[model samples]
Target: MATTILETCRVPAPPGAAANLSLPLTFFDIQWLHFHPIRHLLFYDYPCSKPYFLETVAPKLKESLSLTLRHYLPLAGNLIFPLNSEKKPEIQYVAGDSAVSLTIAESASDFDHLTGNHARDADQFYEFVPEIDPVTDESEYQRVPVVALKVTLFTGRGICVGFANLHCLGDASSVVGFIKAWASISKLGGDEEEFLTKHAESLPILDRSVINDPLGIDTIFWKVIRDVPLKSSSFPLPTNRVRATYILRQADIEKLKDLVLAKKPGLLQVSSFVVTASYVWTCFVKSEEQVDDDDVLQVFIFAADIRARIDPPVPASYFGNCLAYGLAKIEHKQLVGGEGFVIAAEAIADQIKNRLNNKDQVLKGAENWLSETKEMTAIRAFGVSGSPKFDLCSADFGWGRARKLETVSIDGEKHSMSLCKSRDSEGGLEVGISLPKARMDAFAAIFEEGLRF
Candidate 1:
């Protein structure tokens, strides 16, 4: 776990990238104001010496990142929470003052084991994660960084690229879009103009007017956040946990869907996401081994991209948080019973059909989302991050595509999991899980047994 610091630099948009910009937060963005920043790690296998990496790879990455910032200026900006209640929070950037902190370092850890499918110590990856600076108290506003970047070289092994971004700045879609753009520019020899011409669809639409909040949900969310202690925003420290990756191939997903249909014939939605998530949830609950009460509730939470579901649909490339919540709850006995997977699937399927797919009521109870979630804080509640649609493995920077990718921030949440498209198998889904070593062992056995016909 030893890592040597090379250098830390501030990377700003190249001169004349754009003028000062201010993008206001929508209700979706405001909800995450007090949460920990989302962190991700992309590991690429490249055999090279430290000198070669410093002389060749480092400059290319920094230059391409600067070029990418030109289009995603808000990423290199600050999240400003104004003291005046009337003035809403916003993502602000000053022409010459805004920049992203990039830290370059080298680690002595085993890249293969760290990127392997087997369970490994969750704290091992913490060295590669870069920390975002704490919020500063300005005269009338609190200023905090939107994003911070880190590039860790494994000497003769490979490199790990990491980023930490405030959720209020954007969601997974926006963050992935920026990464793809940066990879393209880096692969094309840092040619910003060429990237713009070839990948015009990748550019982000920064307009905040497209999102309409007719219910004053934003006001309700702001009031809730005002009572929260800002110190709670600090990132979670590593606990005694082990992280692992599991894949549900296309065939496996099909079996799960069939099982759900056999148990509940008229279920409305049995998508891969629902089935896979349900199976995972059931296994996790069973792994606990102590929750035997029939009435105890196990809550499962996940989010959906609402860009296409909105009334006047927002652009797919809109650079902000536009999401709807999907929550499902099942009793302890039902989740740990002989037909746990089927029952969990039915619950999740119904939730998606009644909430997520129902455009008219997608945001129906959003005003109480934060409060309701807080109430479940003491229960056995778990959530999922990322989505298979992101296809994060496809991100390439002239080197080959990422050998492995992880949502490192899930380590901060209690028993949360991450989902993404599989790197080796087409149409397959990858699920990342973190838990105590003993619990992880139990979950692994349950997961494998459930997949067998």
Candidate 2:
């Protein structure tokens, strides 16, 4: 698990990009104002030596990233917060002052063991993933970095590209769009014209006005933030954490859906995602051998892409965070008992149906979000991160598809799981979970036995 740092440099957007840009945060974006940053690592198998990678691939990556930043200037910017505490924070980009920090490193770790399905030490990944510096106090303003990146060469084995971005800057949909665009540019060797022709529709829509917060949720959220202490945007991953991946084929998803329908035939929102998330949620609850109180409440938290759900409908290409929180709660007894999967599935599905479909319900509890988030910290809550729709594997970057993509941010105390499209099978899904050794073993056993039916 040794890593040697080769270089640390900043990559700026091309001169053609608009400079002195300031984008205000919408209500959806404000929800994550002080939340932990999101980190992702995409592994590609490239049996090449460090010298070759440095001489060829690294330059292309940096150049392509610079070109990609022209369209996503916010990535190279900083979030400026006024120390006055009255004005809302905004992402501001100044041509000469802003650039994304990129770290070049070489890791001697085992590429296969790190990316395999079997459990591996989560801390081993800390070496390759770049860190986002904490907010720094500036006179009259506090500046926070929006994004940072790293490229690690596993000499003669594979290369791992890592990204860390502020959650307030974008959601999964927004970030994934940037990754795909960067890959397309890198694939074409930073050919702006050719990349434009092929990826014209992929460019992000930077207009923040489309996100209408009719309920004044923005003001309410800021007030809430003003009341509570802001959370640190740092990855304090605990030791002894192990991560494992589980694949659920299309058949397994259908089986789970059928199982749920057998008991509740009229359920309206039993999509592939719902069943998959629920099954994992149930397994996680059962694996927690310490929570024996059947009456204890367990909350399930997740985010839903709201591009098409909002009134007047936002464009799918709209950049930045356009998400609504989906929450469901049930007693531990119901979630872990017989028919636990079905129970969990129904609860989550109902929440999604009502939260996303009804505009009024979309921001129903907006005022309570901060307080509830605090309460969730005390209760046993299960959350989900990433989504299968993002399709991280499709980010080819001209080196074939990614060997594996992981949401390394979920390895903390959040008790969250990551979802992605399976690499081996179409229509299948991959689940990445991190937990202590004992809980991981229990979860793995329950996950397998439940699939036998």
Candidate 3:
């Protein structure tokens, strides 16, 4: 399958948008300063005329994107580290000219295979993601685009809207909100005024100061990550690594939950997420061969949104990152041994509770934890990205809802998995995981066997 680039252009905010706006980064935003761009793809099947898409649909998408930017002005700007400034870098939305790069392309790939619910090669989705290159000046100050978009028409089958956003700009919730807003506008024929009036309830709060960090977390975060070098290659996964999507049906999820409750009858925190995460973590550990050191620690690192947990709660629609990472650690033997699921679930649930209960302390100690953990070269780490809570399947443009939504960028990273609610919206879950080919096969076996009560 080959993808051909047709055209590339910039889509700026609509007229009368606030000009020369500078939004300071909070500790949550700066914590992910060196992280990779978040890539997401939404595939839609429109078996209609190519002329219809080019002449009608394409123009609406571009126009709607412009209007969407009017509300999300920061996305049209860049993140720059200003020279001689004591404060950390910030997002600057320059008035008239700043815009997001939009690439128009065409692909002849198998649309069904790419969007199918089953597993396929992780690398295949890379072609649909656009490259977001951050430019650096002679003074060594770096300026990076906050977002880039690509629209590809899969000849005679469907179209895909590819998104790439710098993690610092926002979290998954913010990005999905942006996408839904764009789609809503596109469906309404790019009516900016109608979009504003109709979806008035969903407008994002761009102010970042509400997240009062009394502990000076922003400074601590910058100091800790400033020296860590950026990844040399954007595409760092080994060739042998592969990605697959696994489903946890509603019945299976409930069964897992029941199993956890059976072991600990008083366990009130075992939800689908906790149980599913525990199952995956245990399978991952069991798939790997036993290590010489039984005491080696296996860590499960996941993030939680502090939007409503903080003292002065941040708005749900607040734009920018508002997440705190939660870590759960267990010795290798204990993690793979019998009763692993129960132990993992208990630890994860407890950690989550602790994080919420001591939100301030957690935020304050985040940098310190990173500093100490970075030195542990031998510890094994696993993390879960993307959440089922972010109902991505409901993102509907005019034509229809997305056939599939994928987190393609994380596939290249080791021991990282993506989770989202099932497309059917039946209280099930869809998990995208990547591993060495052999380990993936072994993990599949363990995943299936463990669920068979």
User: TM-score of model 3 relative to the true fold?
Assistant: 0.94
- Residue pairs in collision within model 2: none
Task: Report per-prediction Cα RMSD to one decimal.
Answer: 1.5, 1.5, 2.1
Whole-model lDDT, model 3 = 0.81
Select the stronger candidate by TM-score from 2 and 3.
2
Candidate 3 regions exceeding 4 Å error are: 83-85, 138-140, 227-233, 237-239, 357-364, 367-369, 372-378
Between candidates 1 and 3, name the one with more favorable TM-score: 1
For candidate 1, the C-alpha RMSD (Å) to the true structure equals 1.5
Off by over 4 Å in 2: 227-232
Q: Tens digits of per-residue lDDT for model 2 on 1-453?
A: 489999999999988788679999887888788777898999999899888989999999999999999999999999887665788878999999999999999999889999999999888888878888777877777787899999999999999999999899999899999999999899988889998998788789999889877788888887767544444465675557898999999999999999999999999899999999999999999898777577999999988898888777899989999877778899988888897889889989998888877776876776677777878878989898999888977898898999998889888656999999999878899999999999999999999999995
For model 1, the run of ten residues with the poorest summed lDDT? 227-236
TM-score of each: 0.97, 0.97, 0.94
Which tens-of-lDDT digit does each residue in 1-453 have in candidate 3? Answer: 599888899988888888778888887888677777888888887886667877887888889998898888999998876544455788988977689899988898999888875556777787888778646553645677888899999878999989988888899889889989989899888877898898888899997777887788788777766665343226554446677778899999988888888899886668788888888999999999668888988898888888888777888999998887777899988988898888999988888777744756556566575564454324688888899787776777786878787887776555778898887648889888877778888988898887775
